[model samples]
Target: MQRPPLDPQLAITFFYYRDLPQAMRFYEEVLGLTLAIDQGWCKIYRICSGAHVGLVDETRGMNKWAADKPVQLCIRVSDVDGWFAYSQSKGLDGLSRLFENDQLGIRAFVFRDPEGYQIEIQSTTRTGA
Candidate 1:
C-alpha cells in the first residue's frame, strides 16, 4: 500500500511587495479576495476554500521585493467569460484576450496585478479537465 502524504490545514503563497498598500488594494478591491489574517506587515487573503495568498511588506518581510516577478497567481473559476467582462471593465494592466488551450483543456485569460504579478483566470473547457 502507498503511504499518504502529510495533510496540511492551509496553503499560502507569499509575495513580497515594495508597496504593500497598493498590493492589498488590488487583491481586496479588484480581485475581491477577503482578508483572512492581518499581521501588520503581512496580510493573508483567502483565494479559495483552503488556498491563500499572502502579501508581505518587503521592508518587514523575510524577502525583499524584486522588479522581475516570475511567479503567477492562477484562479480557476466556473465563469471565464463573465470574469473577462468584469476584468475589461476594470481596465487591468497587461490584459490578454480570452483564449483556450486544448492541451490544457482550459479557457483562460491573464492580466497583471498592481505590482506586475501575472494573474490567470481560467475555467475548464471539457469534461474531466
Candidate 2:
C-alpha cells in the first residue's frame, strides 16, 4: 500500500490600511520581502522558510475587530542590530526602545509600519527558546 505525501503549512496574517497595494509596496520595498502573489484584493508575500505573510482588507466594514487596535508582528532577522539601525536611518519610527531582556535573552526592538502596526525585530540566535 502506498502512503500519502505529507504537507506542511504556516502563515502570518496582517491587517492593512484599506489599501492592499500600498501595504504590498511597504512589505516588499521597505521590509525587503518578495511578492509571491497578489490577487488584486488579497496579497501574499514570501518572508522565510516557505512561510508567507498575508495582507487582507479588513477596513471594508467587516466585523473583524470591534475597534481598530494596534497589531503586533514579529520579524526574525539574522542581524537584529543591522535591521534596527537601518530602519532608524530610513527615518522609520521606532515605537518602543530597544532593550535586552534577561528573561527571554532576546535583544529586541519595536517599530511601527506605515499603517501604525507594531512590529518587533529580534535575533534568531537569542536564547528565547
TM-score of each candidate? 0.94, 0.77
Which tens-of-lDDT digit does each residue in 1-129 have in candidate 2? 998887767565646556667777788888988877776666778878777777777654233422444567787777888887777877776546667877776778887776667778887545546
RMSD of each: 2.5, 4.1
lDDT of 1 by residue, 64-127 (tens): 8888989999999999999999999999999999999999999999999888889999999898
Model 2 Cα shift for residue 21 (angstroms): 2.5
Pairs that clash in candidate 2: none
Query: In candidate 2, where is summed lDDT lowest over 10 consecutive residues?
Result: 60-69
Alpha-carbon lDDT, every model = 0.95, 0.71
Q: Among these predicted structures, which one has the highest TM-score?
A: 1
How displaced is residue 84 in candidate 1, in Å? Answer: 0.5
Off by over 4 Å in 2: 1-7, 59-67, 124-129
Clashes of each: 0, 0
- Structural RMSD, model 2: 4.1
Q: Which ranges in model 1 have alpha carbons more than 4 Å from their true place?
A: 1-5
